[model samples]
Target: KVPTWTFHFQRSKRQRDDDALVLPQNQKNPKASRIAYKIEEYNPLLDSSNITPKDWAKIGKDIENNYMDYDGFVILHGTDTMAYTASALSFMCEHLRKPVIITGSQVPIYDVQNDGIENLLVALLIAGTYDIPEVGLYFHDKLYRGNRVTKVDAESFGAFSSPNLAPLVSTGVNITVNWNIVWRDKYQQRFQVSTEMNQNVGLLRLFPGITATTVRAFLQPPIEGVILETYGSGNAPDKDKALLDALKEATDSGVIIVNCTQCLRGTVSLTYATGAALKKAGVLPGADMTPEAALTKLSYVLAKKDLTLEEKKWVLFKNLRGEMTDAAGEPKLCLSDSRFIQAIAKSLSLSCTEELGAVRDALTPSLACAAAKTGDIEALEALKQLGSHLFFGDYDGRTPLHVACCEGNLNAVQYLLSQGATVHAKDRYGATPLSNAVHFRHKEVVELLRETGAHLSRDELDEAGVELCSLAASGDLEGLKLWILAGADLTKPGPDGQNVLQVAQSAGQKEVVATFSSCS
Candidate 1:
C-alpha cells in the first residue's frame, strides 16, 4: 500500500480544451480501495512542447519539496514530445529511488474509446505497488526506461517502444516484471536533482549530396553540442573533404560533436573509412542511442560546468540512466580449477592471492588468451581477479579480444570490453579486433567492436586481406561480401602466392570459385 501524487503537465492529445485541470480535482472512487492507494493532483499544467529545462527544474523542485510525502509520482504528458520530456526528467532527477512514471494517451478519458483512463490507472498502480524506482514511461502494455523509449507510432495504440533495451515490465494477462533487467541502486543513495540543462545543442542529419555549406552553417556559433546523424553505421562520404573539414573545425572550436546512426536498430559504428574520418575529426560515437536520448544527454552533459569538455565527452558515451546498452554482458567465471572459481566468486580482491598464485603457476599468458578466445567467462573473471595483466600480447601481438573476435565469441568480446579492453588494439601485423572479426565473418562481433569505436586505416585493411582470403578459401560468402563492401583489394595474392579464386578452387570451395569466376 502506498500514497500517490499526480503532477499533470496537461499535454494530452485527447483533451478537448487546454485547461489546467483535465479531470476533477482530488477525485477518488471505489477503485482506490482495491489498489490500496490515495490519489491527489497538482495544478498549473502546460503543453509538452512548452515544457523546457526551466519546467524540468520546476518538476524537480516540486518532487524534492514533496519527496517524503509520497512513495511514487506520476506525470501526465503529451505524446507529441513525451519521449523528450521523459528523457529530460531522467537526467534532471538524480539518485531517485522512487518510481516516476510518465504516461499519456492518444484519446481523452471522455471519449467512448479512450486509452488515457487505462494508462493512468496502470501507471498509478505500478508507481505505488512496484519497487521500480527509476523514471519510466508506461505506454500500451509495457514499462520502458524513460530515456530509452521513443514514440514510434502516431496512430497506433502502442505509441512507444524501447529499441535498444528490454522493457522493465510487460503487462498482459499478468504484469510480468523482469527483475533482472530492472535498474536498481545497491547503496540506496539520497535523491538529488540537476536543474541546469544547457539548451545550446543542435542535431544535423546527413543525406546524399548534403553540402559543406549546409553543415558549416548549422554548426556555426551558439551551438555547444551537435548530434551528427550519419548514414548506416555512422558513415558519411569520405570523398566529401569539405564536410569533414567543417566537422573538424567545429570539434576544434570545442564543439562536442556526437556521431549517431540514422538507422534505428543498430548502433553508430566507426569501422568504415568514412566513419574513421569522422573519428579522426573528433566525433564521439553515440552507440545505439536514439536521437532523443543523444540530444537530451548532450544537453545534460554540457550543463555540467564543473566538468572539462573531455570529461563531458566521456560521459556522453557511457550508459547513464539505462538510456543505452553499453555492452552485451558481464564477465562470468568459468574455470576448471574449483579453488580459483571459488576465490573469484567470494570476492574480487587480493584475499584470493593464494588461489591466484596457484592458477598463475599453471596459466601462461597464451593460455589465458586461449581462455578468452574460447569464451571462458569464468576463467577470464578469475584471471582478472587474480590481478593478471590484460595487455599481454601473443607472439603475433594479438590480444584476447583479437582471438575472441576471430572465434566469434560475442559474450567474451562484450565481457572483455566491460573490463576496459582496448577496442582499437593492433597486432604485430596491424590487425585489429574488428579486422579479425571481419576476417572470420563474425558479423555480430564486428558490429560490437565497431560500436566501441574500432576503426582501421587503408593499410590495415590491406594487411587484413590475407585473413579475408582464408575466408574466401573456406567458401565464406558473407565474409567475402563484407570485405568487398569495405573496399578490400581482392586482387591481392594469398600467402601461397595464389589469388583468392585459385585458393578457393584448391580448397574445393566450388561456390566461392564460381563467385570469383563470375566477377572476373
Candidate 2:
C-alpha cells in the first residue's frame, strides 16, 4: 500500500549570530536578508515516482498553512518525478504569492561528490529572497517555471529543462532572476489548495498501425479525457477511416481528446491536412503542453464538478498556470526540416524560373510572418523588396498583421498597416488583428487595432468582454469563471473603460481576481 503523506510544520527560528545557522562562505548569499526556517523529514519517504496527487495536496496544503509565516518554500524532492510533482503543485496551489521551488540532485545527498547540497542551498536562498510568485524547479543552478519543465536526462547534473520556456532564475556568483517572465498576481486572492483531482484521464500515444480496437478500448468507460500523442504538430493516420472513426466516436460521446505533439518542443497547430482531419473529428489542440502537464491539467480541470464537458475543453485551450505557450498563430519552422530538401530537389528538376519563383513565393509568407512575430522590420523590408506579398497568409491563413498583433509588436503592426497589409484580415478561426490583440493580452495592440477600425462582432467571440469588468468589480466569482469558460478576452477593457484585472483590484475583489490568471 502507498504510504499516507503528511506535513509536520515544526517551527524553530535561527539568526546569523547563532552557530546553528552556520554555512560555508561560498554556499551563502551575501545579498539575501537573514531567513529562518524549519525542516521536516517525512516518515517513510518514498522516491518521486511513488508520489501521488494525495502527496501533492499535502504539499500544497502545507504551503498554504504556512504562507503567512514563511517568505517561500523549498521541497527537496527526488529527480525521477520532480517535474511531475512541480507541475501538479503549480495547478494545486491557487493564487500563489510566493516561490515554491522543487529541486533534487542526481548524485545522492549522502554521496561524497554530490550536487545535492549546492542545489538545495541555492533553492532555499531563492525561495527566501526572491519575489517569484509561481512554482519553480531548481536543477543544475537554473530555476525553471515548474509546469514548463521536463526531465531531459538522468545521469547529467542538468536533469531538467523547460523546453518551450526559459528558466526564471539562474545562480552562480550572483543570482540572476528573470523578472520579466515571473508570474505576478495582480489580485491579492486568498490562497487555497485545490485537492480535488480526478484521475480518470488516459494517455494514448499514436504509433504506426495503431488499431481502431486499441483506440476504442482506451476511450471506454469512466475515462473522461485522453491525451492523444500524435506525430509532428499533432498528425495521425488520416487515411485510416476506422482509426479516425474511433477518435470521432470518443469525441462525439463527450470524451475530451486533446491532441499533443510527440516532439519535445513545438505547439500542436492543426495546419497540415492530417491535423485538420483530426480537428474535423473534434480533437482539441493541446498547444505546446508537455504530456505530464496535459495529464495533470486534465485531472485538475475534469475534477471541476461545476464545469460541463465543453467548458473543460475550453479550459484546455487556454494558457492557464504557465503550463503552455499560446503560439497565437505564429509561423513555426526549423532549418533542418525536409521541406528545404524538397525545395532544392524541385528547383534542380525545374528549368522554368517562374515555377521556381512560385515555390519561393509560397515560402515567403511564412518567413514574413516570422519576421512580424519577432518585430524584425529589416527582415520584413528585405522580403518585401524581393517582391514578397506582405499580406499573404501562411498555412493557417494568418497574415503578418495578425502575427504582429499576437506578438504585441506595435512597431511591426504599424509598419504592416502602413505598407498596405490587410488590417481586417481573418485567420482560419475568423480572428482578425483586433481579436488576436485582445485575446493575446496586448493592450496597446488592441487600442491601435481598434483605432484602425477593426471591430469584433458578437458572433466573433464566445463571450463579449464588455461585462467582465462589471462582474469583476462586483466580486462575482461565478460570473468571472463563466466569462472565462466562454472564452472572453479577459485582457480586453470592458465597456466601462477598464480591464477586468484592474477593475478587480480597484474593488478589492480578491476571489474574483483569483478566478483568472494574469495574462503574462
Candidate 3:
C-alpha cells in the first residue's frame, strides 16, 4: 500500500508525521506588510509530476478562501508542472486585479547556491509591490506572464523562458517592468477564484506515424476535451483519413478537439490545406497558446455545465486572459516599428545607427524572432547585413529561421537559407526549422527545407510500435511483413501500452494474429 500525505499549514507545526491536517503558526497571519505570507505545506512534499487537477482546485479554493486577506499570492511549487498549474490558475482565478506569482528553485532551498531564497523573496516582493494584475511567474530575477512561460532548462538557474513575449519585469540594480504590456483590469471587478475544473481533458502530441486506433483508444470514453498538438501552424496528416475520421467522430459526438501547435511560438491558424481537413474534422484553432495553457484552459472551460458545446468552443478560442496572442486583449508591441526598436536601444544605451555592431546588439534574438513571425523581411535583411547569425537563439533558444518557418514567411525563410542557416538547428524543445515548418503546414517552406536536406527522425514512432499496431489494425499484412523484415519488434507494446498481438486480436484481424504467431 502507498503512504498517505499529512497536510500542514507550517513546516514546524507537524509534531506527528502521520497526521492528515495541521494548521500554521499564529505569527504567519499578522497584519499586512511587504512580503507578508503564510506557509501552506503538504507533508511528503509532492514532486510536481504527481500534482493533479484535484490538488490544483484545492490550491485555488485556498486562495479563494483568503483572497481579500492578502494583497497578492505566491505559490512555491515544484519546477515540473509549474507552468501547467500557473496556466490553470490563470483561468480559475477570474478577473484577477492582484498579482499571483508562482516561483520555485532549480536547487533545493536547503542546499548551498540554491535559487530558492532569491526566487521566493522576489516573488513576494513583486506580489506585494506591483499593481500588475495578472498571474505571473518569477525566476532568476525575471518575471514572465504565467501562461506564456515554459521551463526551457532542467539544470540551470535560468530554467524558464517566455517564448512568444518578453519578460514582464527584469530585475538588476533596478527592476524594470514593461507597463505597456502588463495586463490591467480597469473595471475594478472583484477577484474570485474558481475551484471547478473538469478532469476529463487530454493532451496528445502528434508524430509522423501515430495511428487512428491509438487516437481512438486515448479518446475512447468519458473524455470531454482534447488538446491536439498539431504540426506547424495547425496542420495534421491529411493523408491519414482514418485518423481524421476518428477525430471527426469524436467532435460529431460533442467532444472538443483544440488544435494547438507543438512548436514553441506562433499561432495555430489552421489556414493551410492540411489544416482544412482538421477543421472539417471539427478541430478548433488554439492560436499561439502553449500546450500547457491549452490543456488547463480546456479543463477550466469544460467545467461550465451551463454553457453548450458551441459556447464552450467559442470560449476556448476567445482570448480569456492574454493567453492567445492573435486576439490579444492587451496592447501589443512590434519590433518592426522603428520607434519601439529605438526605445529598446535607448534603454540599453545603444545607438540606433548604421553601425552594424551596435545594430546587431540591439537586434536581440527575441525581437528578431518576433519580426520573423510577422514576416518582416526588412528587419531580416538588415540583421543579415549587420552580420547577425540567424542561427543564434534568444535566452529561450528560439532561432529566427524556425520562427520564419513557423509563420510560413517564404521570403525570410529563403533569405535565411541563402545566408546558410542550419536547416537542422533545434530549439529548446528539439524542434528544428523543418519540424516547425511541418508543424505549421508551411508547404513551401517545408519543400524549401527538404531541398536543403532538412529532415527529422521517425524513430520515436517506430520505437513506440505505432507502425506495427497501425498495420495490424488495418490488416496491412504486406506492410507488416516489410516492417518486420526491417527488424520491427512484433512483441512490442503499442503506443497505448498494449501489445501488438492484442491490438490485432481486438480488431478481429485473424490474418494479423496468424502473422504474429508466425513471427513468434
Candidate 3 clashing pairs? 231-439, 231-440, 232-439, 232-440, 233-440, 267-288
RMSD for all candidates, in order, please.
27.7, 16.5, 28.6
Clashing residue pairs found in predicted model 2: none
- Judged by TM-score relative to the true structure, which candidate is superior, 1 or 3? 1
- Tell me the tens digit of each residue's lDDT in model 2 across 9-54: 1112234223324233333534333455556567778877788888
**How high is each candidate's TM-score?**
0.59, 0.60, 0.58
- The Cα RMSD in angstroms, rounded to one decimal, for candidate 3 relative to the true structure is 28.6
Superposition error at 156 for model 3 (Å): 1.3
Better of 1 and 2 by TM-score: 2
lDDT score for residue 353 of model 2:
51
* Residue 348 displacement in candidate 1 (angstroms): 33
Q: RMSD, model 2, all Cα superposed?
A: 16.5
Off by over 4 Å in 2: 1-32, 328-520
Candidate achieving the largest TM-score: 2
After superposition, candidate 1 runs with Cα above 4 Å error = 1-43, 186-188, 333-520
In model 3, where do residues sit more than 4 Å from their true spots? 1-34, 186-188, 328-520
